[model samples]
Target: MAAPSHGLTAPLSGKLKNVNFRIGFVELGKKKKRVFVKCCSSGFNGSGICIEKCENWKFDSRKINHSYRVKVQASSSTMPFASPKSRFVSKQEQFFPRCTPRNSGPQSHDAPPKRDTGIANEKEWGIDMSNENINESGTNEDGSTWYRKSGEDIGENGYRCRWTKMGGQSHDGASEWKEMWWEKSDWTGYKELGVEKSGRNAEGDSWLETWQEVIHQDEWSNLARIERSAQKQAKSGTENAGWYENWSEKYDAKGWTEKGAHKYGRLNEQSWWEKWGEQYDGRGSVLKWTDKWAESELGTKWGDKWEERFFGGIGSRQGETWHASPSSERWSRTWGEEHFGNGKVHKYGKSTTGESWDMVVDEKTYYEAEPHYGWADVVGDSSQLFSIQPRELPPGVYPNIDFGSSMPPDDEPPPNR
Candidate 1:
C-alpha cells in the first residue's frame, strides 16, 4: 500500500487557471489519455455547488486495489479541489476487460494496419492459418447507416474470428442505434469458445439512454451465460434524473437456470432501487425473490421484499412477503402450501404509533395462469442467445486490418457496474 499523494494544489492568490486535467493509463497494452472539462469559470460565482468523485484502481504490481478520491470544496469564491495522484481501473475494466474496447474514441470503420501476424498451434495441428480482415461503412438508401469490421484466422481444424457491426437511423433531431460484436473460436471435433456483445442507444430532446448486453459460451457443457446493463438520464428545466441497472443469467441444456438483477436510480428528491431473480429447474420447479427499497430527501423510507418457491412448476406455492411504509407502518405475511391446499398463514402489522397486530389462519393460493416471475426479459430467447458454433464469415471479402496494436487507447473507463 502507498500513502495518498496529492496530485494538484491551486494557488490562493485569486488568479484563475483553466483546468487542464489529464491522466494516463496503460490498459490492454495501450496507453490512454483522459481530458477533463475546463474549470474555474466566473459563471459559477453565485451558484452553490459541490462535487466529489472516487475511483478504484488496481496496479499490476500490487496485490490490493487503491482508491483515488477527488473532492471539490463548496464556497462562493472558488471550488478548491483535491485528488489522489494515482491511476485507477473502472468496474467495467475489472470485470469485462476482453469484451470492452480498448479505445474510447468514436469507433470508425477503419481498421488498424497489420503489424505482424503469425500462426499459432501450427505444429500441433499441422495447419497453416492466414489472417483475413474486413472494414466497410456506408449509408443505406433508407437513410440508415451501417459499418462492419472483422478479422479472422482459418486453419485446417477450425477458425477463430472477431467482428463488430453497427447500424441505426437518425431523423428529426432524434436517433436510435445498435452495435454488436463477437469473438469466437471453433475446432473440429474439439472445443469451442466465444463472446458476443450487443448495445443500443436512444437520444432525443433533453434525454439519452443506452444499454449493452454480452453473452459468453464455451464447449465444456455447451452452457451459456448472459450479462446485461442499462442506463438512462434526462433533465428538464432545472430538474434531472438518472437510472442504471445490471443483471446476469446462466443456464445449460440440463434444465437448470439461474438469474439475478438489480437497479437503482434517483428522481428529484427521491431515490429508489429494485432487484429480483428466479431459478427454474428443468423438471418443473422454480424459486424466486424480489426486493425493493426507496428513500426521500426528507428522511422518509420504504421497502418491500418477497420470496417464493413453486414446486413442480406452480403446482404448489410457498413464500413470504414484507412491506414497509414511509409512515413507519410495517406489514408481513408468510404462507406455505402443497398444490394450493393444506397451507397455513401468519400475518403481522405494526406502526410507530404503538399499534400492532398479528394473526394466523388457513390459506390456499394458486396461480390462475403462468406466473411472469419478476423481471421482464431485456433481450428475448430466455437469456440464452448464443449457440456453440461461431458465426460464419462471408467468402473472399477480406480487407483493411489494424492488427489490434494500432487501435487508439480507450479514453473513457468501462461503464460502472
Candidate 2:
C-alpha cells in the first residue's frame, strides 16, 4: 500500500494470497520512489494494491493457476529484488491519479480552452501612495480598485481624527462604487462630520445614494444635523421599466425636529408620486405633519394629508389628523384640550376617536419641562468614537475588512519586521 510520507512509519506487515507482485515507481512530491508488494485483501478485484483499507498503489495483474499465501511488508526503506522473473517499471506515475485530461491531442479542438478575460492581456495597472499619513491605494487582480487613508493629531485640550475610504468594482460591463469620510474633533468646542456615498451602474440602469451629518457641541448649545438622499432609475431592463425615485431628509438634535421629502415614478409612462413630512419636539410640545399623493402606472390615484400636535403635557393638548383614499374611505380626528391653573381640565373635539370627556389629571401633568436629546443616540462615547485608530499594515498585507472589491493582486512577502 502507498502511504503519505508523513504517515509511513516502521515496516507494515500484512498478508496476501494468490498474488503476483511487481516493482514500479510512483511520483511523490518532486521525487519518484519505488513501489513494491502490490496486492489487495478481502476480494477487491482492483488493479491497485491495498493493505488493510489502503487502495491507491497501482500494478499490473495476471491470472495465476496456483494459489499461495504471501506476506507483504511496506516500509519507508526500499527492498532489493533479485528474482529472474521479477519485472520493474520505471515510468513515473502519480500514486493516486484522480483525473485524466480529455484534451491531450495536438488538434486545437482537443486542446484545453484558454481562460479569456475581456482584454487579450489585461495587465494590472495601479499606483501606490502609501506614506506616514496615508496607506493602501491600488487595483486588484479582478479589476477592482480602492483607496483608504486615516490620520490623527493631538491638541492641547484633546484630539482629532479623520478617515476616508473609497472602493469600486467593474465586471461584465457593470460598475459599483462606494465611499465614506468621517472627522471628529473633541478639542475645546467639539465638532464632528461624516459623509457616505454609494452607487451602481449597469446597462440602462443606475442608482446613487448619499448621507451626511454634522454635529457641534459648546457651552451654550448642542446641535446636530443629518441629511440623506438617494435616487434610482431603470430605463430598459425591468418590469414597469422606466422607474425613478428620489428622497432627502434632514434630522436635528431635537427629538423630532426632522423633515423629509420623497418622490418616485415611472417617468417614461408619466406616472408619479410624492410625499412631504415634518416633525417638531420642544417647549413641552410635539407635532407631526405629512402630505402625500400618488398616481400609479395603472391610472390609480390617492392622497393623504394629516397633522397631530400635543402641548401642555398629557391630557392637555390639541391636534387634528385625517386621511382620505381613492376608495372614498375617510378618517378624521380633532382635539382641543386645556388645563386650568387649579388642576381642572377641559377637552373638546369635532370628531375624536377616543373618549373626549375630561377628568382631573396628575398634579405634574402640566409642569414646565424641556425635552433633551442626547448625542449618544446618534454618536457614541469617547471610547467607542475613537476606537477606530489609524492602522499601518505593511506593504502586501491586506486587512480583513471588506473593500467592496475583489482580492488585491498578489505581492512579494514583506520583509520581517
Using all chains and alpha carbons, the TM-scores for the candidates as numbered come to 0.40, 0.38
Error of 2 at 181 (Å): 2.2
lDDT of 2: 0.39
lDDT of 1 by residue, 51-164 (tens): 222232222321124423323323412332332221222111122111112222122111111111111111111111113454666553334444545556455434554444
- Summing lDDT over every window of 10 consecutive residues in candidate 2, give the lowest-scoring window: 105-114
lDDT of 2 by residue, 105-159 (tens): 1100000111111111101101111124654555544444445554555543344
Give the least accurate 10-residue stretch of model 1, judged by summed lDDT. Answer: 110-119
Question: What are the runs in model 2 whose C-alpha is more than 4 Å off?
Answer: 1-132, 135-139, 145-161, 171-173, 184-190, 201-204, 218-283, 297-300, 313-376, 379-417
